[model samples]
Target: MRKHAGEVGRYIVNGLVATAVHYSVLMANLELLDFQSAGVANFVAALFGIMVSYFGSRYFVFKNTVESIISQASKFGILYGLIAILHGFVLFVWADWYAFSYSTGFLIATVLQVSLSYLGNKFLVFKK
Candidate 1:
Protein backbone atom coordinates (compact mmCIF):
# COMPACT_ATOMS: atom_id res chain seq x y z
CA MET A 1 0.00 0.00 0.00
CA ARG A 2 2.80 2.37 0.84
CA LYS A 3 4.39 1.92 -2.58
CA HIS A 4 1.18 2.18 -4.56
CA ALA A 5 0.21 5.76 -3.83
CA GLY A 6 0.85 7.06 -7.32
CA GLU A 7 -0.85 4.09 -8.89
CA VAL A 8 -3.90 4.65 -6.72
CA GLY A 9 -4.19 8.23 -7.92
CA ARG A 10 -3.76 7.17 -11.51
CA TYR A 11 -6.36 4.44 -11.02
CA ILE A 12 -8.86 6.97 -9.70
CA VAL A 13 -8.34 9.25 -12.67
CA ASN A 14 -8.47 6.38 -15.12
CA GLY A 15 -11.51 4.97 -13.40
CA LEU A 16 -13.34 8.25 -13.79
CA VAL A 17 -12.64 8.22 -17.49
CA ALA A 18 -13.72 4.60 -17.72
CA THR A 19 -16.86 5.35 -15.77
CA ALA A 20 -17.69 8.10 -18.21
CA VAL A 21 -17.41 5.64 -21.02
CA HIS A 22 -19.52 3.17 -19.10
CA TYR A 23 -22.33 5.59 -18.30
CA SER A 24 -22.38 6.92 -21.81
CA VAL A 25 -22.78 3.50 -23.30
CA LEU A 26 -25.27 2.47 -20.66
CA MET A 27 -27.45 5.47 -21.37
CA ALA A 28 -27.18 4.91 -25.07
CA ASN A 29 -28.18 1.32 -24.68
CA LEU A 30 -31.10 2.11 -22.45
CA GLU A 31 -32.34 5.02 -24.54
CA LEU A 32 -31.23 4.31 -28.08
CA LEU A 33 -31.13 0.54 -28.24
CA ASP A 34 -34.39 0.39 -26.37
CA PHE A 35 -33.17 -2.46 -24.27
CA GLN A 36 -35.81 -3.69 -21.92
CA SER A 37 -33.35 -5.39 -19.62
CA ALA A 38 -31.10 -3.16 -17.55
CA GLY A 39 -28.93 -6.15 -16.77
CA VAL A 40 -28.27 -6.84 -20.39
CA ALA A 41 -27.71 -3.20 -21.12
CA ASN A 42 -25.28 -2.96 -18.25
CA PHE A 43 -23.45 -6.04 -19.41
CA VAL A 44 -22.94 -4.48 -22.80
CA ALA A 45 -21.88 -1.20 -21.32
CA ALA A 46 -19.45 -2.94 -19.00
CA LEU A 47 -17.82 -4.68 -21.90
CA PHE A 48 -17.00 -1.35 -23.43
CA GLY A 49 -15.98 0.19 -20.15
CA ILE A 50 -13.76 -2.76 -19.28
CA MET A 51 -12.05 -2.50 -22.63
CA VAL A 52 -11.19 1.10 -21.97
CA SER A 53 -10.06 0.27 -18.47
CA TYR A 54 -7.88 -2.56 -19.72
CA PHE A 55 -5.85 -0.28 -21.94
CA GLY A 56 -5.71 2.55 -19.45
CA SER A 57 -4.87 0.25 -16.59
CA ARG A 58 -2.16 -1.52 -18.49
CA TYR A 59 -0.49 1.54 -19.94
CA PHE A 60 -1.35 4.21 -17.42
CA VAL A 61 -2.68 3.13 -14.06
CA PHE A 62 -0.76 -0.01 -13.23
CA LYS A 63 2.17 0.70 -15.52
CA ASN A 64 3.28 -2.84 -14.94
CA THR A 65 6.90 -3.31 -16.01
CA VAL A 66 7.48 -6.89 -14.98
CA GLU A 67 4.47 -8.83 -16.21
CA SER A 68 3.55 -9.90 -19.67
CA ILE A 69 0.57 -8.09 -21.16
CA ILE A 70 -1.09 -11.38 -21.88
CA SER A 71 -0.78 -12.51 -18.31
CA GLN A 72 -2.11 -9.29 -16.89
CA ALA A 73 -4.88 -9.18 -19.47
CA SER A 74 -5.99 -12.72 -18.72
CA LYS A 75 -6.24 -11.96 -15.05
CA PHE A 76 -7.87 -8.64 -15.75
CA GLY A 77 -10.41 -10.34 -17.97
CA ILE A 78 -11.28 -12.85 -15.32
CA LEU A 79 -11.59 -10.24 -12.62
CA TYR A 80 -13.66 -7.81 -14.61
CA GLY A 81 -15.83 -10.57 -16.01
CA LEU A 82 -16.80 -11.60 -12.53
CA ILE A 83 -17.28 -8.01 -11.50
CA ALA A 84 -19.48 -7.28 -14.51
CA ILE A 85 -21.73 -10.22 -13.77
CA LEU A 86 -22.13 -9.09 -10.21
CA HIS A 87 -22.66 -5.53 -11.38
CA GLY A 88 -25.47 -6.60 -13.69
CA PHE A 89 -27.09 -8.47 -10.85
CA VAL A 90 -27.01 -5.41 -8.64
CA LEU A 91 -28.54 -3.28 -11.37
CA PHE A 92 -31.19 -5.87 -12.05
CA VAL A 93 -32.18 -6.11 -8.43
CA TRP A 94 -31.93 -2.43 -7.56
CA ALA A 95 -33.53 -0.86 -10.61
CA ASP A 96 -35.57 -3.59 -12.20
CA TRP A 97 -36.97 -5.42 -9.21
CA TYR A 98 -37.05 -2.63 -6.65
CA ALA A 99 -38.13 -0.02 -9.14
CA PHE A 100 -35.28 2.32 -8.26
CA SER A 101 -33.71 4.74 -10.65
CA TYR A 102 -31.25 3.16 -13.05
CA SER A 103 -28.85 5.99 -12.44
CA THR A 104 -28.79 5.35 -8.74
CA GLY A 105 -28.31 1.62 -9.17
CA PHE A 106 -25.53 2.22 -11.62
CA LEU A 107 -23.89 4.54 -9.15
CA ILE A 108 -23.99 1.91 -6.46
CA ALA A 109 -22.57 -0.73 -8.74
CA THR A 110 -19.83 1.59 -9.94
CA VAL A 111 -18.74 2.28 -6.39
CA LEU A 112 -18.49 -1.43 -5.70
CA GLN A 113 -16.48 -1.94 -8.85
CA VAL A 114 -14.10 0.84 -7.92
CA SER A 115 -13.04 -0.77 -4.68
CA LEU A 116 -12.91 -4.28 -6.08
CA SER A 117 -10.95 -3.18 -9.12
CA TYR A 118 -8.36 -1.26 -7.17
CA LEU A 119 -7.62 -4.16 -4.89
CA GLY A 120 -7.67 -6.76 -7.61
CA ASN A 121 -5.49 -4.78 -9.94
CA LYS A 122 -3.03 -3.95 -7.23
CA PHE A 123 -2.61 -7.40 -5.76
CA LEU A 124 -3.64 -9.78 -8.49
CA VAL A 125 -3.41 -8.43 -11.98
CA PHE A 126 -0.82 -5.68 -12.26
CA LYS A 127 1.51 -6.89 -9.52
CA LYS A 128 2.90 -3.45 -8.89
Candidate 2:
Protein backbone atom coordinates (compact mmCIF):
# COMPACT_ATOMS: atom_id res chain seq x y z
CA MET A 1 0.00 0.00 0.00
CA ARG A 2 1.11 3.56 -0.62
CA LYS A 3 0.52 4.53 2.99
CA HIS A 4 2.67 1.69 4.26
CA ALA A 5 5.33 2.59 1.75
CA GLY A 6 5.39 6.16 2.96
CA GLU A 7 5.62 5.01 6.54
CA VAL A 8 8.45 2.66 5.68
CA GLY A 9 10.29 5.38 3.84
CA ARG A 10 9.95 7.76 6.75
CA TYR A 11 11.06 5.00 9.08
CA ILE A 12 14.17 4.42 7.03
CA VAL A 13 15.05 8.08 6.90
CA ASN A 14 14.56 8.58 10.60
CA GLY A 15 16.48 5.40 11.29
CA LEU A 16 19.43 6.38 9.13
CA VAL A 17 19.86 9.66 10.98
CA ALA A 18 19.55 8.07 14.37
CA THR A 19 21.83 5.18 13.50
CA ALA A 20 24.50 7.53 12.25
CA VAL A 21 24.49 9.35 15.54
CA HIS A 22 24.39 6.14 17.52
CA TYR A 23 27.06 4.23 15.62
CA SER A 24 29.34 7.21 15.36
CA VAL A 25 29.41 7.60 19.10
CA LEU A 26 29.94 3.88 19.61
CA MET A 27 32.73 3.65 17.08
CA ALA A 28 34.41 6.77 18.38
CA ASN A 29 34.30 5.66 21.99
CA LEU A 30 35.50 2.16 21.26
CA GLU A 31 38.00 2.85 18.51
CA LEU A 32 39.25 6.36 19.17
CA LEU A 33 38.88 6.68 22.93
CA ASP A 34 39.63 2.98 23.40
CA PHE A 35 36.86 2.24 25.83
CA GLN A 36 37.61 -1.05 27.51
CA SER A 37 34.03 -2.22 27.62
CA ALA A 38 31.56 -2.20 24.79
CA GLY A 39 28.63 -2.03 27.20
CA VAL A 40 29.76 1.29 28.58
CA ALA A 41 30.45 2.58 25.12
CA ASN A 42 27.02 1.45 24.00
CA PHE A 43 25.38 3.22 26.91
CA VAL A 44 27.08 6.46 26.01
CA ALA A 45 26.21 6.09 22.33
CA ALA A 46 22.60 5.26 23.17
CA LEU A 47 22.19 8.54 25.02
CA PHE A 48 23.30 10.49 22.00
CA GLY A 49 20.99 8.54 19.72
CA ILE A 50 18.08 9.04 22.11
CA MET A 51 18.26 12.78 21.73
CA VAL A 52 18.37 12.53 17.98
CA SER A 53 15.48 10.11 17.84
CA TYR A 54 13.31 12.12 20.23
CA PHE A 55 13.55 15.34 18.30
CA GLY A 56 13.53 13.73 14.87
CA SER A 57 10.42 11.73 15.58
CA ARG A 58 8.74 14.58 17.41
CA TYR A 59 9.05 17.00 14.53
CA PHE A 60 9.87 15.10 11.38
CA VAL A 61 8.83 11.48 11.65
CA PHE A 62 5.70 11.46 13.76
CA LYS A 63 5.07 15.18 13.86
CA ASN A 64 3.41 14.85 17.21
CA THR A 65 4.18 16.93 20.24
CA VAL A 66 4.87 14.95 23.35
CA GLU A 67 2.83 15.50 26.49
CA SER A 68 5.94 15.82 28.61
CA ILE A 69 9.38 16.15 27.15
CA ILE A 70 11.04 14.49 30.08
CA SER A 71 8.48 11.75 30.32
CA GLN A 72 8.48 11.04 26.62
CA ALA A 73 12.22 11.08 26.36
CA SER A 74 12.69 8.95 29.44
CA LYS A 75 10.13 6.43 28.37
CA PHE A 76 11.67 6.21 24.92
CA GLY A 77 15.17 5.94 26.36
CA ILE A 78 14.26 3.17 28.76
CA LEU A 79 12.45 1.20 26.10
CA TYR A 80 15.19 1.62 23.52
CA GLY A 81 17.85 1.01 26.11
CA LEU A 82 16.43 -2.40 26.81
CA ILE A 83 16.33 -3.10 23.09
CA ALA A 84 19.92 -1.90 22.73
CA ILE A 85 21.09 -4.30 25.39
CA LEU A 86 19.69 -7.17 23.40
CA HIS A 87 21.07 -5.75 20.17
CA GLY A 88 24.61 -5.26 21.49
CA PHE A 89 24.59 -8.59 23.20
CA VAL A 90 23.66 -10.40 20.03
CA LEU A 91 26.24 -8.60 17.95
CA PHE A 92 28.97 -9.17 20.52
CA VAL A 93 28.17 -12.82 20.80
CA TRP A 94 28.04 -13.33 17.05
CA ALA A 95 31.30 -11.50 16.55
CA ASP A 96 33.02 -13.61 19.14
CA TRP A 97 31.57 -16.83 17.84
CA TYR A 98 32.16 -16.27 14.14
CA ALA A 99 35.42 -14.40 14.57
CA PHE A 100 34.05 -11.51 12.58
CA SER A 101 34.92 -7.89 13.12
CA TYR A 102 32.87 -6.24 15.82
CA SER A 103 32.24 -3.33 13.52
CA THR A 104 30.57 -5.51 10.95
CA GLY A 105 28.42 -7.24 13.49
CA PHE A 106 27.54 -3.95 15.04
CA LEU A 107 26.37 -2.55 11.72
CA ILE A 108 24.05 -5.44 11.15
CA ALA A 109 22.69 -5.29 14.65
CA THR A 110 22.12 -1.58 14.42
CA VAL A 111 19.91 -1.97 11.37
CA LEU A 112 17.81 -4.57 13.09
CA GLN A 113 17.55 -2.54 16.26
CA VAL A 114 16.59 0.57 14.36
CA SER A 115 13.72 -1.19 12.62
CA LEU A 116 12.45 -2.56 15.89
CA SER A 117 12.79 0.84 17.47
CA TYR A 118 10.74 2.47 14.74
CA LEU A 119 7.93 0.04 15.37
CA GLY A 120 8.07 0.56 19.10
CA ASN A 121 8.19 4.33 18.90
CA LYS A 122 5.39 4.51 16.34
CA PHE A 123 2.96 2.06 17.83
CA LEU A 124 3.68 1.99 21.52
CA VAL A 125 5.48 5.03 22.80
CA PHE A 126 4.12 8.04 20.93
CA LYS A 127 0.81 7.00 19.51
CA LYS A 128 -2.06 9.48 19.39
Evaluate model 2: give its TM-score: 0.82
Q: Across residues 78-111, which tens digit of lDDT does each residue of candidate 2 receive?
A: 7788877877676667565665776787777787
Per-model root-mean-square deviation over C-alphas: 1.5, 2.3
What Cα-based lDDT does every candidate model obtain?
0.92, 0.77
Name the 10 consecutive residues with the lowest summed lDDT in model 2: 90-99
Q: Which stretches of candidate 1 lie over 4 Å from their true place?
A: 1-3
Runs of candidate 2 exceeding 4 Å displacement: 1-4, 96-99
TM-scores, all models, native as reference? 0.94, 0.82
Can you write out model 1's per-residue Cα lDDT over 14-122, one digit (the tens) per residue?
Answer: 9999999999999999999999988899999999999999999999987875788788889999999999999999999998899899999999999999999989988
How far residue 118's Cα lies from its native spot in candidate 1, in Å, is 0.4
